[model samples]
Structure formats: C-alpha cells, structure tokens
Target: MRRATTGLDLALAGLMTVAACAEVVISGGGGTALGFGVAATLLIAFRRRIPLVTACGVTVCLIAESVFVEPPDRAVPMFVLILASFSVAAHANRRDAAFGLSFLSLAMITTGALDAGDDVASLLPGWALFVGIPGGVGVAFRKRTGDVAVMEARAAAAEVAALEAVEAERRRLARELHDVVSHAVTLISVQAEAGQAVIDSDVEGARRALAAIGAASQDAVAELHAMLALLHEPSDESTGSTSTGLADLPSLVAGVRAAGLRVELVTRGVSALPPAADHCAFRVVQEGLTNALRHERNAQVRLVIDHADADSAIRVESRGTRHQSSYGGSGRGIAGLRERVAAVGGSLEVLDHDGTYCLQAVLPR
Candidate 1:
C-alpha cells in the first residue's frame, strides 16, 4: 500500500513537470519562464514530505517570475504556488505552516507593491484573497482529517475491549456449566452403579438408589433448561438465581450417601452470607462432593463449614477410596472451583495427605 502511494506521488510530480514544460512551449515563454517553471515543478514532488520547504521553493519561483518574466501568463503552470500553500497547511505542523504562510504573504505583498506603482493599495485585497483562501481551506481539511482519525482510533479501541469482555463472560459461563453438569452427572452415575449392584441383592436399597438417580436426573435437566434459557436472553430474572445455598447441603449429602459414600456435614457459627459468597460456597461444596464420588467411592466424606461476619469458610475431605467407581473426570472441577473462589474474593487451599484429598476455601463475608 505504501509503495502504491509513493508511486502515485512520483507520477503526480512527473505530470506537473510535463505540464510546466508544455506551458512554456505552447505560450512562447523564453529562458526565465522555462527555468522557474521547471524548478517549481521539480520541487513540488517533496510537498508531502517537506511541505514548508516545497512551499518556500514555489513561492520563490513565483516571485522571481513576477520580477524577471515580462508579459507573464498566469495559467495552470502558476497553480504550483496554490498547491504548495495547500500542502503546507494540510501536512505541516503549526510552526511550519505559520512560517510558510508568513513568507508567502510577505513575498506576494512585496512583489505586488513593486509592480502596482502608485496603485499599491488596490493590490492588497487580491493578494489576501488568493493567498489566504487556499491556506484556510487546507487548514479546515486538516482539522476534519484529524478528527476523523481520532474517532477511528477510539472506535477500534472500543471494539477490542468489547471482544475481550465477551470472551471473559464465555469463560465464566463455561465454568458454571461444568460445575452444574459434572456434579449432577457424577451423582447420577454413582447412584446408578449402586442401584445395579443392589437390584439383585436388596430390593429396598436398590429402590432408594433409583429414586436418587431420578432426582439427580431431574435436577440436571432443570438446571440445564435454566442455563439454556439464561443464555438465550441473559437478563431473564427467573433463570438467574438457583436459590441453592448452605441449607441445601443436607439433601446434597443424602444424594451422595445414596450412591454408597458415607458422608457427614458439620457446620459452625452459621450466619447469613451474601448471594455471591453463598453461591461460591455451594459450588465449592458441590465440586468437592462430585470429586469424592468419582475418585473415592466407598470412602468417608466430611464437609465442615463456618459462616461468620468476618471469615466464612467451607472445607471438604475424603479418605482414600476402598472401591473404585466406574465414573471419572478430566480434573477441571478444582480449577473451575478456583475461579469461583477468586470471583468471590476468596482463598483456596488443597491438602494431599498420602492418598487422601482435602479442599479448603475461605471467602470474605
């Protein structure tokens, strides 16, 4: 693109040179006209790169023509002065523009005064109109161009920021979906396994296991529907909150226990928590239970939660499993829980003691 623009500039310079020479040839200009025309045209090539210098060169040529070339032809060739003034105003900085305008004005005034004889006062208006108009128009164009450039830059920045925000939201939603689906699926898999084993041996135990499976499946389907509906119109109030919190832990434990994992819930200093903190706590518990059910079947699980004014916390620990379950995971549960902890301004600590796994999370009230 830059090469194409440079080529066009060079072509314009060549055309200007050709036009200057042609003017001299067709209008019978002798040595002085030919020299000034060729010099001004050649200098015009650098107008964009060194606008003030090109403007000064063109002004010098125009003044020299007025002094030396008799019976001057103010034709297309002389328009090089206007073009130089426009370039200087449009491309050069304020200091260079001021200097170029000052120099051009002084030169034109002096030349017109010298040629006007006693009618010098009459030449001022014509000189001002010719010299000021092009410069003013160029300055206006430069301002508009600068404003447009600034607006374009701001628009580009806003677009990038918006895209980044959307990506962050998608990641959050992905983490949420993982937590929901993993917990429910893990519970269902564990219960179904238990139901299969007990169906042949104990009919009552098998019935309870199947019931837990149905409940887990219903919860999974409901949560999925809510999640999908929220995705469609995100602002829908009914689908926003799950209304699941610390109070739901008993049922959660019961569901997991039906899967054949011995579980206990111990709470200390229970108090009301903010919705965000409450939700984070619930997810932490859910993810921990899901992990235990998958990797540590037939092992004892303990959930300890402390809800207070200053420091609220939840801890889950699972002893090594005696029996391995059929269901497993890719291990994104803990990482997703970590993101949840961070969102609620909390800290997470994991403990590895021999084969046992313990997860502890502390959140601000």
Candidate 2:
C-alpha cells in the first residue's frame, strides 16, 4: 500500500472514534447505542475501503433510528461517514473512491427521502448536498493525487538512470586515459634508462638509443594530442581527415615488425570496407597487436582481415602466444570491445587455446 493511503486511513480511524465517543456521551447515550457502536467499529476496521462498508452501516443507522426510542445522535454517525468518504477519496485513487461514493450517495439520498414522511420532495436538496457533492469531489481529488504519484516516480527513475550512465562513461574514460598515458610513459622511461646504462661502455649505441627515445617521445606527444582533441573538441574541423583503418594495416604491421617481432598481415576484403566500419575494425586490430607485443613479446603474430561475403559482415583475427600475466589488462579489454561492437550490432571474442590467444570480431554493415 502507498504510505499516504495508510497514513490517511489510520488518521480517519482515530478521528472518527474520538468524535463518535464524544457525541455519544453528549446526546444522553441511551437508545440505538449498539447500532452506532457497531457502525463505528466497522468504519475504523475498514478505514481504507470505508464508503463501501459505510453504505451498509448508514442503512442500519436509518433502520435503528426508526425502531429505537432516544435518537442519541444521528448527526454523529453521519458526520463520521462523510469524513470516511473524503479520507478514502484523498488517499487511495479516484476510480475506486468514485465507485465507493456512488453507492454511499445512493444509500444516503434514499434514506433521507424515506425518512421524510410525506415531505420527500423537500428533502431532495439536502440529500444532494450531503451525499452527491462530497463524494464527487473526493473521487476527483484521489485521481489527481494518483497522477501526481506516477509523475514523481517516473522523474526519480529517470534521474537514477541518467546518473548511472554518466558514471559508466567516466569509468571508461579513466581506463582509456590510463592505458594510453601509462604505456607511452613506460616506453619513454625504458629507452632513457637503456641510453644511460650504455653511455660509458658503448657511446655509439647510447646515442642511437637516445635518438630512438626522441622518436618515441614525439610519437607519444602526437598520439596524446590526437586523443585529447577527440575527447575535448570532437568536431569535424578539429579531427581532420586522419583515420586508422585496413588502408593503414601494412604500415602498422611494419611498425610492429620493426619493434622486434615477425608480424604477418593478410587481407581478403579490401573493396567492401565502409570507413566507419573500417576505422572501428582498425582500432580492434591495433589494440590486439599492441597487447600481444607488450605482454607476449618474442612470440610470432598472425593478422588476418577477411571480408567474408563482402556485404553482410567483416571479420578480423589476430593470434599470438598466450600471456598469463599482462601488465595493463585485467580481462576488461575484450569486454569493452564486445560492448563497442554490440553498440554497432557486432560481435567480439577473445579465446586463449592451445598456447595461442586469438582475438576475433564480426561487424555487420
């Protein structure tokens, strides 16, 4: 049950009991006491669905009034019924309270006219005011309250969902920045250390290594600038026409081979590659090869791009010796790749079997 509804019912029960008891004591408290007490008990016990029960209680009140002597207080029980109708209408909802009220109004009007004793027409206006107006208004207020509750709940849910989305994106950005910055810094540090260690014994080698360090640092700066621009100002002007794709795969393979490993690049799908598809595909292959080099160095690598069917899908696969312990990943790379693919209605898989780690992707057009 809604909290508002429960609170309303409890409050009505308390108020009715106290008011009914006070009136009973004031009005001699003699005849039809049992009927009034019973009606009060029923209304309090069934406070939420009061009008339905009160319809029956009010009918009994009219009957008890005819059969008994002292009319201790007819007004008190009628007032309690009025209060109960309003309480139910305000808390529960309009549709239910409307139905409850219809019956209560009919019972009240019929009872009033019946007790008129040949002046039934004069009693009509009083019946309408006492029963018709309050019940109708009670139902309207209940419906308005229900609509307000629904709107509040939707607003709360939307806010929660939005916050969760922002948090997830922040975590993704943190991971991306950490991986790129750390790997570049590590390479620069390793090269500087090698140059320092060899400066005295091998002057020529130290100078050559320092030159390589300079090149790596420049490459790092360029990459940092590219990524930062993509993040901070991702407009058409700032990004330019530069892209990493299958068109650039040969150069990428050559770069990895130069880094001291044999890399085989094979392609079967050149004519069917969309630029966006190719770009996303290129990142997957680049990240895969980089992971293999950094974690499983000294292992042979095979890179293959197959444009299977040339229309429905494209697949890229890279394999190398498996790494049990990689410095950068905690197994979230493949999951992130899968999430990216799923965004574009694609699929990704990474399997380490028979001493080889194979990364595969299938992207749709």
Candidate 3:
C-alpha cells in the first residue's frame, strides 16, 4: 500500500512539474518566474522525504512567482502550493505543519490581494478554502494512520504474549505428568517384580502384589483423567468430579500404605483451605511420599499440617532408610512441587538434617 502511494505521489509530482513548466512557457515570463517554477517543481520530488523543507520551498516559490511574473491574472503555480500544503500536513510534525499551512495560506491570500482588480473579499475566501481543505485533509489522514498503526502494534504484542503463556503452561503440564505418572509406574513396577518373583511359592503374597498393582494403575488413571479434564473447557459435572484436594489425602495415604510403606498423617488447627491451597498441600505430601518410596525403603514417613502456627504450613519428613532401594528418579518431583506451591503464592523448603529428609510448604491464607 505504501509503495503504491509513493508511486502515485511520484506521478502527481511529475504531472504538476509539467504543468508548472507549461505555465512558465505559456506566460512567456522572465527568468525569475521560470526559475521559481522550475525550483518549486523540482522540490516536489523531495516532499515525502523532507515535506517541511519542500513545503517551505514551494511557499517561497509562490511568493516569488507572484512578485516577478507578468500577466498576473494567471494564477500560476497554484498546483504546487496545494500539493505542498497537503504534503506538510500528511508528513511533517505539528510545528512544521502549522507553520507551513500558515505561510502557504498567507502567501495565497497576499498574492490574490495583489492581483485582484475587484473586491479582495470575494477572492480571499476561495483561496483560503483551497489552502485549508488540503491541509485539513492531510492532517486527518496522518492522525488516522498513526492511530491504526498503534492498534496494530498492540494487537501483535498481545498475540505474542498469549503464545508465550501457552508454551509456559505446556511445560508446566509436562512436569506435572512426569511426576504423577512416574510415581505411579514406579510403585506398579515394584509390585509387578515382587508378584512375579513369588508367583508359585507364595500365592497370597502374589495376590497382595497383584492388588497393589491394580490400585497403582487406578491411581495413575485417575490422576491422568483429572489432568485431562483440567485441560478442556470445564462443564459443571467435570468441574465437580475431577477436582482433588486435602480431603483426598486419606485415600492417598491408604494407597501408599497398601504398597508396603508406613505413612503417618497428622494435622492440628488446620481448617479447610481454598481448593488451590488444598491441592498444593496434597501435591507436597504426594511428592514427598513418592520420593520416600523410591529412595528410602522401610523408612518411617511423617506428614504434618499445622495451621495454628503464624504461618500455615504442611511438612513431610522421612527418616533415612537402613536399606536403600534400586529404584531411581529424574529428580523433577520436588521442583514440580515447588513450582506448584509458588503458583499459589506459597513457599517450599527442603531440609536434610542428620539422616532425615524434610519437605515443608507454607501457604498464605
């Protein structure tokens, strides 16, 4: 569009320059009028690049043509005046635009007054209208162009930010899935190995192991469903069904216990929290216990939530195991928990004192 407009400008300036040359040749003017006409025409080529300078140059030409040209009845070089005035408003800054318009309008009025053999009032209005209309139109075009450019820039910026936010959320969900699925699969793998090892010799032990595998599989599926439900637009039924919170911790503990780990849950002065806080608290406990399951076999784990303290806090501690397990992890569990807690305006702390590993989260009410 801009290139097309520039092409149009060049065409207009060329046509106007030819008209200016015709004015000079037809009038059979002296060198002064011809020189002024030529100079004004040449200056139009630079109007887009240096509009103020070109407008001023054309205004000076108009004045010179008025003073020096003979057969003053001919309104010569008026096209250049109008074009320069329009260019000034379209391209120049406020002060330059104002000054250019004023100078060109006054020059037109002055030339009209000097050339008139009749009432100056009749001619003044027509010339003023001629000068003012182009200037006004140019100013309006400039303002509209600027406003549109601003809106477009803001829209582009908003789109980029939205894309960046979606990317960040995908990364967050990836971390979450890694932690949840990894924990469940680890327990299932352990149970499967045990069940296979004692399949014939110990039938009851094999039965219990199979049950644990089933339970782990169910837990993994439930968690995955909850996450998937969260990803879509929530309907009333789905919203109520898949949400997990502090109330679900008992079942979580029961599942962990069934997998042959001892977990103690203790709470004091901890009333029901908001869903986000409750969910974060649940995750902290879940991740802590998962870590214990992987690294500290037969370790005693204590999960504590205390709201009576100045800062409402949940703590998960595991006394180091006498025998470490072969199971390992990518170590994203604690980091994911920390990010989750931080998202809800909470803080997480992990402490290793002597042989005990403690993970604590303090959340604002």
Candidate 4:
C-alpha cells in the first residue's frame, strides 16, 4: 500500500511537471499550486484506493486548469491528468476502469474538436475515432477479464466433479469387497465347523470340509487382493476380470433362500446392463437379500430387477410381517448401496413405511 501511494504521488507530480513544460510563460505558478495541490490532497486522502479518488481528482484538476490555471487553455495538461487518472482506475475492476477510460477518451476528442475551431462536424468524427479506438480496446480487455472469470468458475466445477467421481468409485469398491469378503468368510466358518463336527466319524467328509475351507480362504485372499489393487490405484479400471455382475443375482438369491428366507426374485430390464452398472446393481440386490435373510427368517422376499437400454434398476422388498426383524442388522447395507449407486451415476432409496421393508436401486447405463 505504501509503495502504491508513493508511486501514484510521484507519477502525478511528474505529469504536472510535463504539463508545465507545455506552456510558454511558465507564469501560472499560483494556478499550478492550487490545481496540483487539490489533486495531490485527494490522492493522499484516498491512497488506499487511489483509483476511486483519482477519477474525481482528474475532473477537479481539469476545471482548475481551464479557470484558474493557464486562463482557459491548458489542453495538454488536462489530457495528461485524464490519462493518468484513467490508467490508475484500469487496475481495479474492469467496469470502473472502462468508465475511466471513456472519460479520458472523451476529454481527448472534445479537446481536438475545440482545437479545430471550424467545421465541428468534420473534426468531431476524426477526433472520436482517434480517441475512441484506444477506449474500445480497453473495453475489449474488460470483456476478456470477464471471460476469464467465467472459465475459472467452470474449471472449478469440473475439478469438483472429478473428485466426486473418484469418491464414488472407492465407495463402490468397498461395497463389492464387503459382499465378497463377508460371503467367503461365512463359507470358511461353516466349513471349519463342519470339519470339527466330523473329525473322526467321517474322515472323508472332514477332508472335503477342510478343502472347502481352504478354497474359501483362497477366494477371500483373492478378493482382498483385488480390492487392494483397486484401492492402491483408482485409475486401473480394467474390468475384464469382473466376476460379479447381474448374471450372478440368481446364485446370490439362492444363497439367502437356502437360509429359509423364501426369497423370490423377478428381474426386468435384462437387455442392457453395462459391466459397471451390472456390478453395482448386483451388489445392491445382494446386500438387500443378505440383510433380509440375516434379520427376517421365513420372510417372503420379492426381488425385482429392472434393466433397459439406458438404465438398470433393482428393488428388494421383504414381507416379514410376522418378524418385523429384516432390517435389524447394522443397516450399513442400504447406506452402502446408496453410496455405490450414486458413485455410478444412479440412486438407491429404502422405504419401509407399511409393515414391509422396501429397497430400490437405480444404476444408469
């Protein structure tokens, strides 16, 4: 701020001296003192925002030039004052700067018209073009500044969108990991228990149980590795190795149905599920079914899978009226579904308002 004030003051003083040289007598010392003093005082008063003060100060100096200084003929001095004031305003806001530029440009044209002293029409157009061209360019710069601001806003939004997309992908991977890891761990536990239950009574059955446990553990490790791979580098989105899709829905339902869920699935929109959409859709249904079976045993479940050329949808509602216990688990399943679908540019909503638990999901293609 101090530097700016000093620079403006020095510049103003120098311009005043130049205007002094434009005179023959150098005898308007009193007028010079009044005019320069008024502008300098205004400068000091508003030095923090010199552009604002300089605008009015330039007009005051012009008036002082015509009346008190040089006796009505200080064209060069007036023009210099105008230019300096406009230049100061140029660094502020573009709109105000344009106003200042116009003021200076008009002053120049008006001065030129006066110097002609005859055929005002001929002199006016030439003067306007000569002065207005610079003003017009200044106006263009103002517009360019506005354009830059608009582009900056769009860039900011794009950055936000990209960040949101990444977060969504991570959330989706989390849901998939939960399903794969949870199911595999359950199988491993069941197999381990079976092996213990029949350690000696049926050696062959026990061996099969052990083998199943090993396979389940390997599957768990592989699933974990896949999840870690995705988490390590999100950009590695090669889904050629995708194992879970809407095609896996039947087995998922059958798993829960075996646990006495009475799970029934009705699928729609079967023709157009992209790999990403299909995977997310399957996750949503699987989580919903798992939740239903875990909490609401013997509950009749109606699973509706809808897909179309543009969208994939899943809705799982359980009629656990006798139990009222289907949605009693951690409730992370629905929340996880919401995050996963939203990540893939879809939506998930669960509404259990009328003695039934209803889960709806949409994953757009």
| TM-score of each prediction | 0.83, 0.74, 0.82, 0.62
Error of 3 at 66 (Å): 2.3
For model 1, the local distance difference test gives 0.77
Question: What does candidate 3's lDDT look like per residue over 44-104, in tens digits?
Answer: 7767767887877877877776766732344446767777888889988899899988888
| Residue 16 alpha-carbon offset, candidate 2, angstroms | 3.1
lDDT of each residue in 1-365, candidate 2, tens digit only: 35223666666666666666666667667536745654654465454554555545554554455345332235666665565556556644556566656655655655554563536665557555666666667767867877899999999999999998777666555545544454445444545666788899999878866776666567657767766676666443113213445676675565555454477776665445555556557657766766665566466777777777633233333345455433455556556666555655677777777767677777765
Per-residue CA lDDT of model 1 for 1-365, tens digit only, reads 25223565567778988988888888888878888888888777777778888878877877787777742445654477677777889888999998987777765665566564426675667555656787898899889889999999999999999998788677767877888788888888877777888798899988998898899989878878877777777552223644567777777787777777787888999757777778778888888888888887467888899877797889999996545556667678788778778877899999979877899999898
Q: Each candidate: what lDDT?
A: 0.77, 0.59, 0.77, 0.60
Candidates 2 and 4 compared by TM-score, better number? 2
For model 3, where is the 10-residue window of minimal lDDT? 233-242
**Clashes in each model (backbone N, CA, C under 3 Å)?**
0, 0, 0, 4
True-structure Cα RMSD, model 2: 4.9
Q: Which regions of candidate 3 are displaced past 4 Å?
A: 1-19, 68-76, 117-119, 197-201, 231-242, 308-311, 321-327
lDDT of 4 at 347: 81
Candidate 1, pairs of clashing residues: none
Query: How close to the true structure is residue 64 of candidate 1, measured as C-alpha lDDT?
Result: 81
Alpha-carbon shift of residue 261 in model 4 (angstroms):
6.9
